[model samples]
Target: MDDSGLVSFFRVESCGLYRIRQKADGEFISDGFPEISKSLFDWLSDRSVLNTIPWDPKEHTRRDKVYCKDVHFDSYTGDYLFVLWFANSEAAGEVGEVGEVGGIDLNSKVGDTNNDSEKIDAKNSTGKELTIGKAMYYWFIPSLKLVASINFKHSKTDIEAFTTYIKKWFDNKNKHPNKT
Candidate 1:
């Protein structure tokens, strides 16, 4: 799979300041789900395959590159597929640009997190005990690195789960210099 294929499979939306077509706001996405649309949600609900995406733990070692030796490569969809987050993405206001891009979320604001699937202590059943914040991901494309900076107000566990998944998928494996 290539970059286009990754976007389609992952269904990544547009970059900052713009909303992608048929996107389900974070609220629409179930508690554990990263992001999905109403259609996807319905489909998954029907099949009862909500949490059945097959991905096992993978081990990866860092393969030094000629240009960016220190930068570690993340998950790959195929032999050449790469999910890159650039170092420049760490700079403020960088993701605020326009035009079609991959894996970028900027100026994200929190709306709601009460999707019913999220578990909360009944003592705080008023629901104030539970909340959600803006989750963001960016690819420092120029730097060929992917950076995710998602913050949460009360959904700490969800945030942790997401970050852990990303790190495991990328950090666990190293790119092979000589590909077959």
Candidate 2:
């Protein structure tokens, strides 16, 4: 958590799209795609109403479609951790083409709640949106207010090896605290 009592919050969509946010002066730091942002806002609005109304299967299905995975936080490092999975690039052909990267159609126009179509322009992205053929592991540090680290794994074995290394490092840190 930061000095303002604001902790970094993250949300990851099923297609590996993600956004990080922190409440500061009534504004949010968001990097989600336009379609994703609309979907998330709609889901949140519906969720609030669902609490007052009876359970509905359609709403449950809608909720599932919006969020398919969980984002975890590493307490030791104060890092918000998550993984982004991508399709095999060799099978997909190229990276820049729509649906060839992270399954997101970059060229598609996303509409707002008022039904106005809004294109996802370059200004909305941070240049790291097109992650292809790799599983990306991210660590966002709240104190730094930025993504401190990102590791890309090309195979299951690579992911496992990195996971083991992270666990070992955390264990070692636990065993030996720095003496000031």
Q: Which candidate's TM-score is highest?
A: 2
> What's the lDDT for all of these models?
0.24, 0.32
- TM-score computed on alpha carbons, candidate 1: 0.20
The global Cα lDDT (0 to 1) of model 1 is 0.24
Lowest summed lDDT across 10 adjacent residues in model 2 is found at 61-70
Q: Which tens-of-lDDT digit does each residue in 1-180 have in candidate 2?
A: 222222333333222122334663323333323332233323323222112112233654332111111235455765555333332335244433444333322222222132111223344553422323433344545454444235322221134433333333233322222211
For model 1, what is the alpha-carbon lDDT of residue 37? Answer: 19
